[model samples]
Target chain A: MPFGNLTYLVGLIVALLIYSAVGTVFRTLYLLLLSLGFLGYISPESLVILLLVSSLSYACYSGMRGQTNRSLWFFLGVAINLTGLFFFREFSIRESWSISSYSVEYALIAVGISFYSLQNLGVLIKEKLQPSAMTIPFTDFMLFSAFFPKIISGPLLRHENFLPQLSPDRNIDWVPGIQRILFGIVKKTVIADRLAYLVNHNFETVDPTGWNNLIVAHLFALQLYFDFSGYTDIALGSARLFGFKLTENFNFPLRATSITEFWRRWHISLTSWLRDFVYTPVAFGLRGSVLGILLAILITFALSGIWHGLALTFIIYACTHAAYLMGEFLLRDFRMKIKVVVGKSVFNLLGWFLTVNLVSISFLFFRSTSCIDALDRIGHVFSCSNFFPSNWKSGFIYKIAVGGDQQNIFNLSITLALTFTVLLAEKYVYRRLESNKIRVGLMVLFMVSIGLFGVFTDLDKFIYGQF
Target chain B: MDNLTQIEAVIRKVFKDDSLIIDAQTSADDIDGWDSLTHLQIITEIEKHFSVKFTLSELLDVNTVGDIDRIIQQKFA
Candidate 1:
């Protein structure tokens, strides 16, 4: 179920109450059952797949315990998970194999299988690498793999990081949890949802005019960040309520000054995962040869693209980033020399502007329905025939005015003002606001603003949940 | 030269810094032009110079010059 749903809120409250009231012995079992129930509620088919993957992982871990052909067990575990992912995600392959319609439908509904399977795969690899590091019971392993908060769209928890927190002695910190949840709710319901309207409308246009496409491209980029990061905040907040600390996925990625820095900040868990599991291994296997390292980076990013979906657009998006990174690598010394010559502040601002625009342009591929559509939208950005901002000003103003509704204008103004205020505060005031009173006051202001002016319509699905 | 001295010479040559000094804790962050690209070049040069082929896991596991020193020692001891 979506985190925004009332049923999920009620369920979380009830579960937390029961969790706190219960003794230490039954806590794991109680949370495990609740997690399984949540999974089953989302899709019975997914629960079945989750159970199968978890069993396969545990069996692999057991087989590797003695270090006899641990590599074989690791490969076997990975093979099974990949086979499941293939069947679930690559439906066209199923069609070629003439798989039954009912089976295809079942595979399609298994939403969280990709994320949870990867979590289990990481566990298997970690076990193979350092057998003595993890010796958790099977039940705790299951809970780690199937935790409800992170199962849907993950910050991709590591077994080592998350396993120790499974203890009943872990203390629940409600203050940060409440603050994060409130921030997540406002970010999603207020900022992302409002921006989604503009993104959808402009992207759906058959022939977007110049400047319109550019505006929409940037809007979609912002919309995606707020949508995905908003989901992450909610997931992290929800997990924190139960004393589990999931990793942060975003770190002001939009403000990054370079593509390398951008990747370091954006979707941090996934990139780090690719770095450790994919790129490092491949690059190392080739003995760190120059060509090998470059190829490893390309291959890792391509796989990351495939992980997003089977779409050509996603592949293009990933390939573009890989190319950007490669370019950055080749020109690092030159850029550093220029930075020294130009002075740091001016160089940083220039780099930030270029990086943001480059990232924004590449996201067109990510947001578009197909490669052709993305190309067309990108091509439209330079067409001078429709570059009349004056002509489009009234319509643009009207759209933001939400069809000239006075209430919507008020709502939009509040959202814009609050968004700028939050950004400025984060930039200027956050570190200085050391006192609890100031922090609490800010939280209260956020809560009151969200209650008063947050957009409640459409309540669209999160962008990253598809992957 | 010892293993560390040989490794330091290889790193200095690959990164084109003649006056570079490296110790156990030295990493990419410590040297100019020591990015992923140059790192591969240094690794390739090390393998050729020492005639020791490191496994993928070994390559990945090494985070510092100290780790490399130990691996080289173990391989050549």
Candidate 2:
């Protein structure tokens, strides 16, 4: 067997055995073996990095357990690991040198390192923060970080809430947990994967010369949302299956009435993290003064941009959002006054329009590679004014969507109907339906649509997965 | 009508709502401006007014201006 396959199978067998046995010592030993086995399979440098990270994670764990200064050893370990990885990936691997930049093979996988690092560091920080709140033992904390379902792409676990649950107090309700996993399976396999086909096709070959690119962008936007949200659903559900309840990552974000609300709904855990740890602190730091507020917004968004990547496109995207948010803040009181004067419907429509367009514009940033790439795409959408995509003309579905080599009434009808149904279901219909029968019905329908029309296939990981 | 006057003043100033008036029994429902985000602002402001810092649990447990006043009195007394 290949080394990767052999290690993977062994890790799973050991974990399953330990998991079935269910003891602190057994689980910890299994995980340690798993980590070592994982390291054994990878490159020597990565193995070294893994050892360093494991040491850091363990230090953070021990620090939280002991209620000390979070093990400077742990902090040093994590900082060195991250900084070193960053240097290796950014400078050396990209350029091709050892000291002078050459890591030729170029496949530097830091997969799950960030998740583990953040979860552990968050544990250390939260321990330093609350001291008495409660800390899970080193074994539980390590396992929580390494939990197979979320280790790779996470609902980005944080330890503050995760720790207390790890103790014996948690009551694992297997029925609902299993049900959640079922929902996730449906979402990932049915809807997300289905949508992935069209979305991937559109983005991979979006031509800037005509109106086809515009249609492609719109398709990509919806595709990206489903792809990311679908992965989150699966992760959350999978966590539930294992008796650990992970947080929801999406809450009908596309149905949000405003940009602020949209953010609160989309990738909810990450947004919450940004708000609580990043946005709030920065915003609060700038507390009383307008300049302080400006500085806070700038810093928060810049950090968000950096979190996405070191790309100019990401930076511009963040800046565009910052500009809109500032404008929204400045105009908040004025808009309220407008609502009083222009009537509720007008005000709401305006707010929703601003939100949708703002999101659409920023998503373009998320999609594009560089500022120029983004700008060229935007130019094509707004200025090209002609030439529909020819590929979409092939299938009846494609014809119905973008056109017979152009836009179609059927596609618009379907999109509008689906969009309307989702909005009503999220907003009103779900609230009215209190019966299990109805919910099951809805789920069945959701599954059917996802299975039939959803996108999936060679999906890149979730947008937040990179962070 | 007691130190409710002082506490309400702090609440109004913190929420930037000069028109807000509340009695001992008044809840956040009766006080329109008092939402969770602003509620924290109110607690922090109340803490500043009384020169006291609220622990996270204490802040989490509070629901009203009177609760704020009582916590303050208990702490400072």
Candidate 3:
């Protein structure tokens, strides 16, 4: 069940209580079983794949401990993980290439393989670096790979960061964990789902126009941010209940003033993974030249795009970001000169505007049916007639936009209001509200708001869960 | 100059901040503009000054100034 479901919430509470009573000796095994149960509930087939992949990684890691040919083990482990990832991710294209049909039935069952494969591969690299120092016990490693909270979507836990925090002796901090869960529920149900209602409606029904597409694209960006980040918050809070800490996935990315800064903030763990594994190796191979860095950016982002899913729109989405970062790099000196001319504040404001628009426009490719559709929509955005606000009112603006049915108008208003309010609150209210009493009060308010405003009619699955 | 001192000098020149002070523990986090791009420039400058080249693995292994110093010392040996 998804985190937003009532059944899942009840199950979580019961799990927390049971977990608190369990002693340290059996805690790891207990949680591992629970994680398996969660996976079994989601997809029994995926649980088997997870167990197989985890076993292979563990076997490879064990083989490396005393071996002179550790690189052999490392490469073997990496190859296995990548092959699993590739088969699962690119299964549909196999027919075109005439690959064997023997495993075709199992293709769609690898739910969390993409994320766990990265974790397993990272462990190999760490083990290769410090042969004796990084050995994890089998049980701990299994739990780390299949931990229920982050298994569906991830903050992409690293072995170095997560292994230390996995001990069974730690105590759960109940209040903050529950608070985080409630806050995440508020973000997902109350804000993101509501916004998705408006965004999905417009994208599906409304004819593609420059004005409408632009607005929907921006809304989709918000919808995506809230959906994914909300899922992360729940994952983090769930991990916290189990006395484990997950890496943070976002850090107020919308406030980023540059594309590089944006990557550092948005989906921080994934970008860092790409940086460490893909970009660093490639750039280093090219002797750390300017050209090398550019090429590394290209290769890393292209892989990143493919990681999200192998599609033309996703590729374009990835390339758009790659281009943004490269532009920032090449224009750094020019931007600095401009920053000196205009004061820092004005320069930052302009940067924020440009970054938000550029990111939102790229989401068009991300959300589109195909790259060509996105291009057509973008083309419409620049057309002379489409650019005129007066022309939009003829039918596009009034009927489908501001003057739509009462429900549509209400959703549009609430979406905009919640988006801006949350943004402003993050900037002003939440940062300064440090009092315990006030925090508790706000938590209650969030719960109440979720009950009243949360869209439960057609529950939406967490968007990142698919990836 | 000592290797640390030489490394410090190269950092100061590449970052264009003469007043910046560094120690063995100094890292990218300690400097204002010592980002990934500037890091490449610093490494390039150090390679030029010391007449040495670092492989991809070696560069990946260097996280702090002390790490770089140790690598250089090992290379010299």
Candidate 4:
């Protein structure tokens, strides 16, 4: 079920209450069952696939113990997980390779394999390298794999960090968890869903005008940021209610002054995963060389793009990011020289401006239906006839949003205002406001805002849910 | 120099922060500008100074200065 669903919210509350009251011995099992139910509720086939994969991994783990060729078993485990991920993500009923009815059915029903495969691989690699660092009990491992909160889109957990926290003796911090959930609801429903209205219009326009492309480019970035991070907040909050802590996935990535810094902040878990497992390994032989760095970045990002899906648009998206990072690194000395000339404040302002636009422009590929579609939209930007922001005051907002209605304007205004409010608070206000009363007031405001402005009728699934 | 002292010097040189202190427990999280790219530079410098090549597994396994030191000492042995 979508985290934004009312039923999911009610279910979360019930689960949290039961979890808190249950004894330590039963707590883990209760959560494991809840997770199975959540997944089984959505796609029973997916739960079966998850169990099969988990069982295979456990069998491999058992085989590796006290064995001479532990590496063989470890690699087999990795290969199995990778095979499962690729098969689910790539295979379809339309493909000629769908030899049987069962293959077609399983391909269609597979869910969250993208996320759980990474989690499973992490355990295999970490345990192989560390050798008996933590002997995870079977139930704890199962729960780690199927934890309902982060199973969909993750603040992807590492074995060392997550496994240790599965103890029954953990204490619950009730208030902050509820506050986080409320904040997430406001972020997802009140802010992100509203922005999705305009963004969806922009995506649908076959012949986007220059102004349309330009405006929606930035809006899409904001829409995605709020949507994914909003989902994260709920996931973290839900896990928090159960006294389990997940790694944070975002750190105000939009404010990053450089693409390098942006990747460090944005989708931190996935980037770090690529860094540890993909980039580091590939770059090892090529370390301490400029060309090597560039090459490694290219390969890693290409893999990252492929991980999202096997599509030309995603490939272009990946290449664009690889190019950005490569360009950023190549010009580091130049940037430093310019920084010296311009002074830090001016330099940073310029960097922020360039980074934001570059990042936004790259999202064109990510949001496009195909590479040609993305290029067509970008082609609008260079057309001399559509150069000026011509439609301003007459129907600029209407053109961008594709509607001139009172309700549309209201939703757009609230989205823009809330977006800025959230940024400003995260950057400035929230840190300084240590008062519990004020914090509680803000929580209540969030609840009120959701009740008032939340777009409940046409709820958009979290954008990252497809991944 | 001992492994820690040598590592400290290499880190300071690579990061261009001579004032930076170092210890066995020091890791990427503890240092500024010690991101993935600069990390390779530090490792290369250490390899050059010690005349030892680290395997990919060894590199992956090294989380802190202590891990690096232990690996280097093992190589020497």
Interface RMSD of each: 2.9, 4.5, 2.5, 1.9
Give model 2's docking category.
incorrect
lDDT for each residue of candidate 4 in B1-77, tens digit (9 for 90 to 100) = 68899999989887666899999999988984477877777888999989999987789878898998999999999
Alpha-carbon runs more than 4 Å astray in model 4: A93-107, A206-209, A382-385, A405-407, A427-438, A458-460, B1-9, B12-32, B61-77
Q: TM for chain B in all models?
A: 0.92, 0.81, 0.96, 0.96
Tens-digit per-residue lDDT, A1-467, candidate 1: 45655667777788888888989888888888888998898888889988987888788877877658888888888887887777777653323210011122223646676687777788877676656655779999899888888888898888878888887798765666666766777777778777776566556553456566676677677778877887887788788888888988988888888888788789998888888788877777775455777798899989989888777888999999999988888787789789879998998899899898889889999987668988997787777676545645355655544455777667557656765555455534323332223367768777786777577663426777677
lDDT of 2 at A389: 51
Candidate 2, residue A205: Cα displacement in angstroms equals 6.2
Native contact recovery (fnat) for each candidate is 0.42, 0.00, 0.16, 0.68
Model 3, residue B19: distance off in Å is 6.1
Go through the candidates in order and give each one's C-alpha lDDT: 0.75, 0.56, 0.78, 0.79
1 versus 4: better lDDT goes to: 4
Better of 1 and 2 by TM-score: 1
Runs in model 1 with CA error above 4 Å?
A: A92-107, A206-208, A287-289, A383-392, A395-415, A427-438, A458-460, B1-52, B64-66, B69-77
Error of 3 at A281 (Å): 0.8
lDDT of 4 by residue, A52-156 (tens): 888788777766775677888898899889888888666642242211111222346367788878888988887776677457778888888899998888878
Q: Which one wins by lDDT: 3 or 4?
A: 4
TM-score of each: 0.87, 0.73, 0.91, 0.91
- Which scores higher on DockQ, 1 or 4? 4
Q: Write the per-residue lDDT of candidate 2 for residues A1-467, one digit (tens) a residue.
A: 11112243344445555555676535445544565554445445555655566566666556546635556644664575457446544433322211111122345655556556556555554554455544455556556656655655567777655655454434434445434444444444444444444445455544645565555555556656655665665555444433566766777777655665676677676666665555655555445455656666667778667655556777888888777766666565676578779898887788777676568757777776556766777776667444555454453345324444333544455554654455455434324332223356656665686566443333323444444
After aligning candidate 1 to the native by TM-score, how far in Å is the CA of A311 from where it should be? 1.2
